[model samples]
Structures are given as structure tokens and as C-alpha cells.
Target: MTTREEVARKAGVSVAAVSYVLNNKPGVSDATRQKVLEAIRELDYKPSHAARTLKTKKTNQLTVFVNYLGDAFEAGILNHLEMESRMFGYFVNFQTYHPEREEELRHFMAGRIDGVFLLGQSLRPETLETLHKAGIPVISVMKPVEPGPVTAFVDIDWTASLQKTIRHLKSEGHLRIGLMANLSETHAHRTRTLAFRQAMKAEGLPFGETDILSGGGRLEAAKAAMLDYIRIGRLGEHTAFVAASDLMAIGMLTACRESGIAVPDRLAIAGCENVLMTLQTTPTITVLDYPRPEASVAAVRLMVEAIRGEPVASRLFDSRLLVRQSTHMGG
Candidate 1:
């Protein structure tokens, strides 16, 4: 079958431009539209389904562009986003945002997808321009160092949250603390890392060379890294550890268990998510309850407002700390 890619090649324009012409969406000039139509005629190209959405009206469709859905935290956010989107008469879908394939984004369901929620992505300036020309608004769930064309950001106050966590750890007598975080250096994780540093600074604690560790954000890699640290006796450097996610905290617990290290006695650990597993573990994890649902609602609302051409501002929600056995001071 003749494909859209073939048609775009024949038209000598971007695949996204072809999509605009096919759906009668604005942003493609008459000259370019004519070329796309001519290419379709020559190639006998047919879209899988004719889009019923009109460019002028709300399609009630939104998509979330994310780095990965594999992480429990991200997956949980997607679940809440879908539920919350329904409350506003919108349907939601998610995609693994591949910044490497820049054109694929604008070329995807162009007419039907109204806006995008960036879970953790940095859309390059050119890619941002393409989305802008295509009339799609992009909103980040985390603040950017420089928001190129992003409509708004809906996120947590990472600095404040981390500082608060630090205070709680300090109260528990964990002055010399270390951080465990994801291996990927996305903007959100980077923000968290910076916040951790600022939090340590505010507490007058020194974060030296061995103070931070990065592994996979999920369970297995975290356990592996912890095991390596234990074997090398680096785990003794800090009385307590602050994990960026609950999964990492659990992995640390698992490592401690395997290595015959007692929790709270040998070390204390605090995590960032208050998910169920945090409680179900043998030693309940101390955590900062991530406001996933609230953030989802805020992100959806901002996208809806932006879709209507309404003025939108960035929103911030706070995470509450929940103390558990994992970070209790040993008697």
C-alpha cells in the first residue's frame, strides 16, 4: 500500500505538512496543500480513517508524551491523567516521546490530538516550532531551564519539597545523608537532583563526591547498585539515605536484607513515593507522598485552558512527608 511517507516524499514537504493538508487542518499554505493533494492523487494514498474532528472545534482529545511508561510512578500518573481527562469531557492517550524522531510527533494523529502533556521531555526549538505551526500546545509536567514554545508547566515545588524532606531527616539525626536517583538525566530528574543539593545546602550538610548514586529508577538496578555499595563498604559513609523514588528505597531495603544489614540500626532510608508497597514492606518506607492525582488534574486543566486559547499559568502542588520505620532512629 502507498504510505504517507511516500506521499510526503513525493510532495517534497514534511509528513506533518501532508497530515495538515489531508485533515484540512490549518498551517499548510494553499501552495503546499495543492502539492500534497497532487501527491495523494498520484500515489492513491488513503488515510486509515477520515477524521471527524474539525480544526475550529475542540476534538476533546489530548496526548501525553513521556520518556517511558515502564516506571511505576509514570504509569500511575498516566492512569490518573486518563481518569481526570474524562471529567473534563476529554479523551487521553499516551506515547513514548521519541525526541530523536522529531517529525513523528507532529505527524501523529494531527487533527484529532488537541494538545500534549510532556511527562519528561525537552522538545528542541525546531520541533517546538513545528508543533507551534501545527497549532498543538505543549505543556511540561516539570519546569524547564528555558521553555522554548511550551504553553505552561504544571509541577511540584521540588526545592521546597526536598528541603522539607531534609528537615525531617535532620530531625531524625541523619546529618550525613546521601541521595539515590534514576540513571536517566531528564529535566524532571535533573530538577530533583538540584533540589536535593539545595535541600542539603539549606540543612548545612555537605554533599561530597560519594553522596549521590544513580542507577535505573526501577527496582532491579537499584538493588544492584546498593549491593555494589554494600560490598565496597561505601554504604557506611552515611547513617541515612534519601531515595528519589520508593522503588529505589525498596531496592535498598532488599539489598540491606541480603547483606545482613539491619534497617534503622545499620542505616535509615527515606523515599519519595507513598505507594502501597512502601507500607507493605517489612520495614515501612518513610516517604514524601507525591501528589500524582493533583498534578494530573492541574496538567489536564492547563491543557484544556490552553486548547481554548485561554491564558494559562504554571501550577505547583506540594508533597507531604510520611514517616515510617525505614527512617526511624535506632535506640
Candidate 2:
């Protein structure tokens, strides 16, 4: 099928300009419109009926771009985003994001979705520019970095949350503390790592590269790393571990279980994101209760406001700790 994207590429014009010309909208200059029409004729472009209708009016469709749909926390946020977006006459769809999939994402922008909710992927500069020219609002959820043409974002105060967790661990008499986190070079991962350093410094504790372990942000990876740490004799005496995610903590628990180390008694552990799997672990993982629903609602609200050309500001939410058997002092 010859899409408007092909016509836009052939005519050397923006996709929005092609859309304007095809729908008889008054946005593109006459010269550009003529060029687009010529390109359309040359390419024999034929849009689908739904695409034809979208060129003329709003489609009321929103996209939720995720790094991975299997993530428990992201799945919870998707569920809430879909449910809340319905009140504004918007429906949500999922899209997997990877740096190499820029062309696929651009092809998806043939006047289909009204806005996008980015969960964890960073859009390329050209993709952001194209979306901007198309007048599409892009709101990121739990993205701490500043937007580069993105409309708005929602995130949590990672420094404060991590500090609180660290203080609690210290108060529980855990003097030798270490951190386990995903090795991905994302804003959230950096924020968590920095916050861990700041919190340890505040508590007058030692923070070094040797104490911070990277597990590539997967369950098996974390488990393997922990087992290696055990074999390397790095699971020091009376140590407390903090993971950047609940899945990592669960993997750490598994390592401890197989090594015959008692949780909380010998090795206290805490994790971020209080997902369902936290409770399902052998020793329920202590985790941070991230405001998933609130963040989802905020993202939807920002998108709706931005789509209407209304001013919107980025938002930040707070996190609370959920103490469980994984780190309970009494246990």
C-alpha cells in the first residue's frame, strides 16, 4: 500500500503537509501542496478508509510506547492509562520501543494516533521533530530527564525516596549496605544510582563501585550476578542489599535461598516498585510503592491538555516504602 509517508518522502515535505493537502486542510503553501499532490499521483498513494477519516479529524487514539510490555509495573500503568483515557474519549494501544525501530515508529504516524505516552523509550531527535510538525503531543511517564520537544512528563522524586529507604535500612542496624541495579544507561537508572550515593553519604556510610552491582535489569541476570557474588565471597557479613527493582530483589532472594542465607536475619534486602511479584516471593520483598495509577492519570491529563493547545507542566509524584518480610527487622 502506498502510504502518505511515501508521498511525503517523495515530495520532500512533512507528513503533516501531505495530510493537509490530502484532506483539503489549509496549512501547507500552494507550492508545497502541489508538490505533494504530484507525489501522490506519481506514487499512486491510496489511504485506507480509516486513514482517510483521520486526515480530516481527530482519531481519538493514543499510543503507549513501552520498552517491554512484560514489565509488571508498566503493565499496571497501561491498565490504568487505558481505563482513565476512556473518560476523555481516547483509546490506548501498545507499541514496543527500541532505538533501531525509528522507521517503524514513523510509519505508524500516518495520521493515526492523536498523542503518545512514552513509558521508558527515548525518541530520536528527528522523530520528535516529525511529531512536533504533525502537532502530536508526546507525554512521558516516569521519565526524569528534560523533554527535547516532548510535550510533558511525569516522574517521582527519586532522591527523596531512595534516601528514605537508606535511612530505614541504617536505622535497622544494617551497617554494611550494598546496591543492586539494572545496568541500562537510562535516566531512571542514573537517578537511582546517584540517589543511592547521596543517601549513603548522608548516613556516613561507605559508597563505592565495589558495593554497587549491575544485573542488566532482568530476573535471570540479577540471579546470576547474585550467585556470582556469593561464589566470589562478596556477600559480606551482616549485609543489607537494595535493588533498583523488585524483580532484581526477587532474584537476590532466590540466590540467598539457594545459598542457605536467611533474609533479614543475615541479609536484609529492599527493592523499588511494589509490583504483584514482590508479594509472591518466598520472603515478600520490601519495595517502594510507586504511584502507577496517579502517574498514568497525570500522563493522560497532560496529553489531553496539550492536544487542545493548552499549557501543561511536568509533574512529580512521591514514593512510599512497603515493608515486608524481606527486610523486616523483627524477622
Candidate 3:
């Protein structure tokens, strides 16, 4: 815990001289530099990384901001981002982005990270503007619901994916379908919800407000929501469900177990953003492979390009259905 002032006092030189020596900047004599180096060694002083970053104009560090780190889909994306970014000599940092934690995110990201990766977290226009004005490059892992001059973004076509999922369920003779979407309003959720409505209309199926339930992006919350639907007899009509996320699908599966409902027999379920845990469920849940690994690679590549003053472009990956034990056989 040695300060430049202490080093200066010990070396019998001004603080500015110690700074110049530590940062390898000009305007310090060799004798003064040697004295400062000796004082630093004697005191076992380590230069501040924050101060050093300011002097060098780079931290070799990037940040990945997520709404929740515990989410399996997000975790998978983060894993790939870290691995790919490291190959380029960049270290990754993580921060949680919540509505209540906006101020904390702003303060933490200011001039600290060389770049940022936003994973499905919505930001205010002002916040985005501030980051743009600061000359910090930011890449979004999901398309923002609101349009802005964001540096870059990567996403998949949720509407087309959901339409395919619904068509599969319909072809399997599922008359009534329900949607499990997160409570929070995000571009992914909104797109999926709208897709569900459009698909239901195309198939001539009835869609009701109650048919779209909030999955809440948590195991416990989704289970509780499904349990509530069951208690009210609302769950009896829907033959199949399309969940916005795998965690919510797993939660609904748990609810079906507690209610003596047999999956793919009395009810079928499918999830978006397939995670590894989906294979571990009692009856493996069907899901849409989100191609997040590829998105991760693309995000990092675009971010590094933007960091290097190269032109950047947004990217979109593909999503495909993966049938499993949770859903009935279909054409």
C-alpha cells in the first residue's frame, strides 16, 4: 500500500518524478529514476493497475454484462466469449445489469474496460449515448428492443424459430398451445410472444391472454406460475407449450411431475436456447439450438475489430429445433 507521494519522500524527489519513472514517461533524470526504483523495491510497492491503465490507454480487459450469471444460456455464451477473447490476449470481466443497478454499471464501466459485451440486458438511451460519447466500443449479444446507435449486435431470428416450433407442435395434433415468456420485457421475449400469436393465427388456433404466462427466468418462479395455472384449471386445455427459455421449461416439467401430469402424453413442452442441463431432465426437454457459441465468437471478433478502429457489423445466427423426449413424435 505505497503511494507515489511516499515513494517521492523516500527517494528525496517530487511525486511527479516518481510517476514518470513508474510509468516510463519522459522528463525524469536517470539518477532520479534509479532512486525511485530503489525506493519502490525497498518498500515492496506495486504500481496501481488502474493508474497504469490510464497511462497506457488500454487495459487488455473486456467486460461481459448479463442480466443474471446463473442462467444456463447466458453462462454458455459467457464461457465461449471468455475462451475466444483469451486467444486474442484479452481478459474478460463480468458485471450484472439490472434496472436497479444502472448507476453501478455506469460507474463500474466508465474508462475501466476496453470493450463491453451486453448479453440481453436493456439499457437506457442516455446510458448508451454516454458510452458512445466516451469512445468505448460495445457489442450486444442480443438485439436491443429499442433502436440505438450501438456499436454492434449479434442475435438469432426468434420469430422464424418460434414459428417453426409452433408448426411442429401443430403438425403433431396439438390443438391448444401456450407460451411461457419471461416477466421482464426484452427483445427476445417480445419477439417470441409476437411469433406465438402470429403462428396461432396462421394455424387457426385460439390464442388467449391467459395462454401467455410469465416464466420469470427462474426455476422457482416458473414452477409457481405453472402451479398457479394448474390450480385454476387453465393448464388442462393446452396440449403443448413453447417456453422462451430452457430454465422455464424445466420448471414447468417439475410442475407437471408434482401434478401427476405425464409429459408428451397429457402435455408436451419445448424450450428455446438449449442448454446442456436440458439433457439431464427426467425426460429430456426439446429445445431450439440458439447457436450462442458461434454468436460468442462473432461478438468477440466484432468487439476486437471495433477496439482496433476497424469497421464493425452486426451478425445474426440461426436457430433450429431439436426434438427430444419431452415432445411427441411429429412429421
Candidate 4:
């Protein structure tokens, strides 16, 4: 709570002197540094992170911006990223990013973090431009946006993952497949959708407009959407569905339970992201192992190097098909 002004007043020096002492800059003499250090000890003064960032131009602090946190989408990523970043002597923080509040986001990120990570949150072009102008590196985790100069991507290969998922569904006796995904046209969502289409085509399955169900990438929303779909009886000839996210798969399962529909037997369902929740479900859900642990470590290491002025490159991990009770057999 002690400010530089208070430290300066206590040390009988100017605020700039306190700043110089705090930063270990060359301007402060040895005598002044000792005085400031003594005063800081006496007053229990702690230099503000913002002040340190301004003085040194390096905070050793990183932040991950996400649409939501604590849910399944971020739990694995955060755990691994924080652990790996700490091993490199960097601190990690999480911020829930809001797309509509670009100005606030831009202001909050300035001088607060050495690097930024986008955990499946979509940012406008201008926002990324602002971060780039500020010389802050941006890395996308999990679901990635479009490839560009501003944001580097880290995720699994969507095409290969979906192709494997489609093949799994095929072996399970599913022909008419549906894709549960986010309605927003974010590059991450688009990539999954396109991969689904490509995979279905390669597997010789039927994919049409009606086969895609927009879930907005939320559990409750997907549940509501699926409930409506069931009421309308629009699920004609579709024996199975693959969710772009595990959350959506769980949501659809809830809807089926409420509607007295059985899973696997009546409507087989599989999803992506083998989050922990998938195993706990009554009928364990099948999924594509997203390799979050590996992805997180890779993302943080790359981000740390990028923040340290090293050459950085995007990384894509492989996804493994996990078959569970929901899709027949165990994962």
C-alpha cells in the first residue's frame, strides 16, 4: 500500500530517486540507494507491478485472456500453463476477455503483462493491432483464431482430429452425423466446422445445413438448443452427433435425459476435448483427447521465449480418438 511518494517523503528524497532505487537504474548513487532501501524496509513499501513494468519494461508477468474461466475449457490449460511458466520464473494471471469491451481490454493489458494468451476468446482486429503496437506478444491457446502477424496459434490439428472422430463414428454404425459447435464465426469455430465437413466427406457420410447445430460453445445454451431440436423432431435419420466441444456433448446428453431419449442405443454422441467431466457422466462420453497438458506446456514455453525477444513459432499437437460408452466401447 506504500507509494513511491510516501517512500520518497520518508527517505528525504524525490519520487524519481525512489523510482531509480527501486529499478536499480544508474541515476541513483549508492548512498541514495541505501537510504531508499532503508526507508522502504521501515515503511514496508512494495513497488507496484505497474511501476516496475514502466521502469524496467519487463514485468515477468503473463496473462491469459478467456471468454470464461474455471469451466472445463480452461481448467487444464490454466493448470499446465501456470506450472510451466513458473518453472521459467514467470508469473501467470487469468483475465476473462469480453469481445464487446475492446477498449477496456486494451487498457487493462497495457503495461500489466509481458505477454498475452488468448484462450479461445475472439478479439477484433483493432484490439490485436493495439497489442501489437504496444509491443506485447499475443498467443492463442486451445482454439486458435486465424493465422496473422499479430497472434500466434497453439492448438491441435483440427482436420486430422475431426477426420479421426468421423472414422470412429463410422465404425460405431453412425452415418447421419451432426456437429455441435459455436455459432459465432470465429476462426477457431470455423476451423472445427470446416474440419467436420471435410471429415464427413472423406468418410462418405451425409453433411448438410440441417446437420449442424449451433451451441454458442456453452453447456446450458447447447442444452436448450438440443431440447428445442428434439421438440421439433428435426433429427430425422441422424443416428449420431459429434460435438465440437465436450461441454456441448454433455449438454445434449442432458436434453436427451429430459426427453426420455437414450444415448448410444438411440442417439449416439461423441465430443471433443476429453475433459474430466466426460468420465463422470452416467454414460461416459467419448471424445478426442485434446492433449491440453502438452499444448499448455508448449504454449507457455513459446510465449516465454517470445516475451524474451526470441524467435517464436506456432505449434499444433495431435489429437487421439477416445471411444467411451456414449459411442460404444471404453476410452
Candidate 5:
């Protein structure tokens, strides 16, 4: 319950100067800012967000709207986003839009946030329109559609990234490859599947229906699909397997191990999102490095630009294939 007034008195500055320093607003010198910060630390002062928002009409908060993924993956990205937002004196709020309720979307749009970042698998056109009309600057982290005037986006070039993976596999003499992906009605899954098919076709590689495995994003779902493929005796026939995410890749790897199949020697595997667990595995999975920190930084920069009424071009980052023991042979 320490107050800003106590800190201002300790620092010998006006309450307004304390406000400017704490809020990181303009019109405060660096030396005065340091004094105010020291006083705040010594006095253990915590500013009231409610009071600050009421007075300035700026919440200094941003929202990230995504589907409900598991805690581990979501926490990794959220931590990076929070760190980047802290540099600009902003806080992040995460909201999961209920799949069946449009009212939830409307409720979240009712003025608790200054800007929004869409991380959902899919965003309806009407919802986008509503957010645009509300003048809330939005930046999409993945699967962004054609944004209107007030919105921007930052994402990986998924098609090219997949193409790079395919080329690496090809160089490793992998002609027959399989793809394991989640079959949820998500824009990202669909787009990446399409990219995989297109890349396979362009390389004149024959990919049959059996080569594509689909399931939910759960480990059990992935294990079930992979085991089903194995029970049908379709596992090691393909030279390589490319999974949509590291989680799925781990499941696929587990399935292969349980089935008494050697990795890389019999079936090479690669995945996206170079998660830490992938590196700690026996074969050390090869994956595409998506640069989550860089993407988060770009998203905030674009959001701040839009907040300041400045123009920003759509931002896209490249994903590089990280080759490791999982895909290496004859070394």
C-alpha cells in the first residue's frame, strides 16, 4: 500500500514529476528519473494502474488473443513477449477467445487494453472488422490475413521455411517423406499443409494420402496416429518425416522408438519451433529455428508505431533449418 506521494516527497519532486518518471512519459530528465526510481525502490512504492489509466486515458496494456494451447508452449512465447513489452513500459494481457462464443470477443474489446496482438489460429472477418472500427491497433503473430489500414502483422514465411526443410531432406537423399500435423480447423495448420504439398509437388516427389498423418495437438493424439501408421506397416518406408511442431515430432520419435525402429538410420525426422526438449533428445531433433524473441520484438515495434500514428510495413521473419544428429548420417 505504499503510495507515489510518499516516494515523491522522499525524492523532493512534485507528484507530477513522480508520475512522469514512473509512467515513462515525456518531459522528465534522466537524472530526475533516476532519483524518482531510487525513491520508489527505497519507499517500496507501487503505482496504481487504475488511477493511472483513469487520469491519462492510456492503459499501457496490450492483449494477446490465442487459442488455448498447453501451458509449456504458451509460457515460452509469453515470457519473451512480456520481456520485450517491459522495455517500453507496457504490460501484456492474454485472453483465449472461446471457440463458440462471439460475445466473448465483444467483451474483450470493451476498453481494457490499448492495443491487441492476435495469436489465434483463426480470426473471423467480422471480428477483424469490429476491431478495426474500434481503432485498436492489432498485430498478428501468426496466420495473418490481409490486414486493413489500422492493423499490421509479424510472422514467419512458412511456405519458404517448409521449402527449406524439404530441400535439406532432399539433399540428405530423402525422396519419400511423410508429414505429421494437427487436423484442427486452424488457418496455420491448413496453410502449412498446403505449403508442404506444394513443396513436395515442386520437387517431383510422390506423396500419397498415407504419407500425411493428421490428429489433434496432444501427445496422445500424435502417438495414436503414428502408432496407427506403424500397425499398418507404413512407418520406415518413408525416408524422412517432417512434423508441424516440436511437440508432434517428439511424439513421433517416441512412437518410432517404441516400435524398435532406429532413428535417422531408418527414418529421419525434422520439426519446426526449435524447442529445448528437441535438443535434449537422444538424436537431438533437427528443426527450423523460428526466432520467437525476434518476432516478439518486431510485433511490439509495429504495435508501438501504430499506437503513435506512424506507418509500418508488414513484418516477416525467416526460419532457418537447424541440422542436428536427428537428420545427420554417414558423418
Candidate 6:
């Protein structure tokens, strides 16, 4: 394999210069940096991550912990996080944690990683405290738990986002709305569910006990919940359905289609996260675009600053509703 020494020899520069250019250090001139990069490409050189970590006293690795919700929406967010971390000269390690497990929290605090990205429902206060005590920085990608000293987060105002959707449905003259939620122990799911309830109440809408469907955020579970609702003769009775994630929304739609229920005519469904599959469906799903890519990039930037002991700013992005064919009421 081609080493940094070989690239430096080919580029007629010192190994230190090659290191500076490869690591994106600011001292090297642009022209010399270009020459070193050209040589690296010609020689197909790859740096040793271990050696780099040892030299810098940094793992150059970030860990992300996501709840066990294996939906397309979560997958899309993970993809963006991976891409953004790469651009910031760090590798990402993702682990699934049980939200209710205190042991999992302890294990995460064992200092295996430089920093952590939390992508689940709200984190426990104790967990935050422990991580803070360990001097580990955490950035929440989508779910912001209560604020603590060491935690920084970026997320949309979920309550307002759901209220907008509820208002849009209300304008369509739909007074009764059904909700499909994962109801998991994670902070994100809980927050979205609470927002849905609050929006329904604020809009003076009657969300009957029969109108709420519980699922596991899996397609099959969501489909089953919808099917049960239909079997109980409650599908078309509610004018609209609100789902916590696009996967659940699509599942609800699939169940509706199989039962010969027309979308937007008999039932309108909307979801969060705006996954690609939601757009490619027959009647596209209306959803809230959370800008996961931008959030991921921003999180990495903050993580890098924190790693360098530099002051960083907290950020939050607004969620926008994308009106699609599924909720085709003139907005």
C-alpha cells in the first residue's frame, strides 16, 4: 500500500507537509496542497486511521446512538449523518440502544468514542448528567430532551409542525382525525405523540379513544394497527390520519388501499420526516421535511468545535410541511 512517505517523495515535499495537506491543516499553501493531493491520488495512498488518531490524541470518531426504530425515515437520517461525518474528517459509529436500559447508558459512557450523537426520543436527565460528568459532548439530531449544561441539540418545533398539519386538515373540513404512533419509550416518539394530542385538543377536534392506533414504528405493525382500525369500522369515519413517521403513514395507506378505502377522498394521511419512499408512492404522502442532511452537517461542525475546545453555537431548524397528493386539499 502507498504510504504518506511515498506520496511526499513523489510530490517532492516533506512528510510533515503531506500530513498537513491530507489532514486539512491550515498552514500549507493551496498550490503545495494541490500537488500533495495529486500525488496521493496517483499513488492511491490511504492514511492509517489508527496512526492519525495516535498522533492527534483524538480518535477522529463519533458515535451515534439511535433508538430501535428501523424505519426509512431513521435510515435516511443515518445516511446523512454518515455522509456529513465523512466531510468533517471523522468516522461514525452507530449503535442501537434500548431507551429503558440504564446499563446501556452506562456502557455508552465508557469513553469508547470522542463524542456522541443522540437520535432517539428525549434522553433521560440522569443520562445527560452522567455524560456531562464524563466531559463528553452530545448533540441531539432530531429529538431535544430537556436542556442541560453539556447538551446541545437541533430539532424542529414538533408541536407547531403538527399544528400546521392539523390546521390544514381542519381547513379541508375534517373534524375527526386519527393518529398512528409508535408509542415507544424513546424521547422522539413520545414528543411527536404528545404534539399530535396537543394539536388535536388545541384545534377543538374530538380525537376519540378509538381514533388512536398504537404500533411499533415498523411497517408490519403500522399495517396491522390500521387494519384493526378498519376492521372495527373506524377508517373512513375519521377524515384524516396523522402518523409520527413516514413509514407508519405508508403502512396506514397500504392498509387503506387493500381495504378499498380511497385516499384524500375517504382518508387523508400525513407524516413526519418526508422519506423518499413517501414521495414515490402512488399518491405521495404529505410530510414535514426535517432537513436531516443540514442538521447532520451542523452537528458534525459543532462536534468538531467541541473537540478542539472551541466555543460552539447551538442551532435549531424549522420544519416545513410539504403538501403532496395524499393531502391534496388546496393549501
Question: Which candidate ranks first by lDDT, i.e. highest?
Answer: 3
Task: Mark the 10 consecutive residues where model 5 has the least summed lDDT.
Answer: 141-150
State the lDDT of candidate 4 residue by residue for 258-318, as single tens digits: 9988888888899888999999997999899999889998888788777767888888899
Predicted model with the maximum TM-score: 4
Candidate 4: residue 44 lDDT (0-100): 96
Candidate 6 Cα misplacement greater than 4 A, ranges: 1-57, 100-111, 123-130, 145-150, 208-210, 311-313, 329-331
Instruction: Tell me which residue pairs clash in candidate 3.
Output: none
Q: Tens digits of per-residue lDDT for model 6 on 1-331?
A: 8888999999999999998886667899988998999999899898887677557545667878876546666777778888988887778988776666756766745555678888754666777677667656888776554455545767777888888898888877788888888776555777788778888888888876667789777777998998988898765578888888888898988998999888878889998888889878868999999888888788788887777667777787778888888888542
lDDT of 3 by residue, 104-207 (tens): 77777787878888885667777787777777888988876654677888988776777778888887888789988875675445656776787778778899
Candidate 5: tens digits of C-alpha lDDT, residues 1-331: 8887888899999999998887668899888899999999998887777787677657788888765557345556777788888898888988775657756776666566778887634566677667667667778776643344437777788878988888899999999999897666654556567778888888888887778898565566777888898899876679899987788888888888898877888889898888888888888999999888888888888888887778877777898999987788852
| TM-scores of all candidate predictions against the true structure | 0.80, 0.81, 0.82, 0.84, 0.82, 0.78
**Residue 44, model 2: Cα distance from true site in angstroms:** 30
TM-score order of candidates, top first: 4, 5, 3, 2, 1, 6
Give the Å error, residue 277, model 4. 0.9
Give the Å shift of residue 103 in candidate 5.
Answer: 2.3
Residue-pair clashes per candidate: 0, 0, 0, 0, 0, 3
Displacement of the residue 326 alpha carbon in candidate 4, Å: 0.4
Error of 6 at 293 (Å): 2.1
Q: 34-68 in candidate 1: lDDT tens per residue?
A: 99999999999876653335534346578887766
